[model samples]
Target: MALQPLPILPIEVLRQAALSRLRAGVAAANAPDADPSALKTLYIPRHRFEKLGPERAPLLHVVAKTDGGEGLSHELPLVASVGTLHINILLASGRAGAVDLDVKAAQLTQAVCLLLLEDQTFLEQFAYVEALRVSMEDGIARGDGGEFDVVLVQIELVMAEGQTQFEPRLPPNDFAQVDMTTDIGPVVGSDPPQDHTVRLRFEPEE
Candidate 1:
């Protein structure tokens, strides 16, 4: 018997793939009316939030980032497991033209969600596990300025492992950790295979 290498993809490659697709989706929706030039899409490299000035109105900020993914039971020819990726698509508009911006943002959100939910492979490699449209109040916009209404479209992806990156863990609650070290195999070395045990954790996120 032999072990086959797993199919892996660069994390940045996957992130950009999702970014481009979403940009296209929003672009296709247009804004308010049939005017294709009515909407503009911008990319922010950091995971933090940013404030949009009056000049940046009628613009969409596409932010993409990822975290370490959990592993899955894989077989031969697939030595590694895919991790979950989260991409946040934010829709924003300045206070001056805020009325129409809301409608436009909603439309863009709809388009992006519909395209992602399609029953086809994304990035020509990974299949999206899920996508959600959530509303974020005050947190995303920093700096003291007229409030900016932002709509968040969060997308989840499962792709092959890449460079290690981890999501900020809510510090472990005041609970003792369990020893997951398991013992298994034949009894040749005085180790009983049938007497093996497994552990499980069901604590809620803090």
Candidate 2:
């Protein structure tokens, strides 16, 4: 027996795909031929991320948020899903630099969005996408002894409907033996009350 397949649109898988594309995009954008951009990308929970120090500034974090779906038709095993993704870009404002942290955040945010929307491989993850919206918010992330400028990018995706199938788990040895017996009464005009016995045996299919 083979293991069951996972959901066609798993949130974790999508999150990883987003991260891969972003990392590649960022690396390409900051290639040796171009001006280097200092940044780190992560896919982790908020609590764990809070433990990081200011040295990890100029970072990009990808987080998968809410997800929901609906059946395309009552008669079919099809579903239409929507997912929310967030990218938090942080830049250390405390660092002494000529460039403004706010401006840097904005630039980084643009790069993230552009990569997500333009990447064909990322877009192919959805079957039939109806719509996609990307929005951003500027704020500050206060830490134990410092604060960093943050650009929060939110992406809402309305994916196309797809067929869903369920598979049952089978035991290691799923063989069974079946036997059945039936009692039949004598014909209507039979001499006396008499019964006949019929036995049947079932076998597994080859």
lDDT of each: 0.48, 0.61
Clash count list over all predictions: 1, 1
Error of 2 at 169 (Å): 9.1
Clashing pairs for predicted structure model 1, backbone only: 68-165
Give the backbone clash total of model 2: 1
TM-score to native of every candidate shown: 0.44, 0.58
What C-alpha lDDT does candidate 2 achieve relative to the native structure?
Answer: 0.61
| Ten contiguous residues with the weakest lDDT in model 1 | 72-81
lDDT of 2 by residue, 1-206 (tens): 53342465465567778777766766665566765543333323333256665446665667766555766665545555666666665555553435575576666666666777788888787666666666667666676557655555555655543455444554555567678999876656657856777899977665
lDDT of 2 at 26: 61
The reply for model 1, stretches above 4 Å from the true place, is 1-11, 26-54, 57-80, 94-103, 119-124, 127-135, 138-206
> Best candidate, TM-score-wise?
2
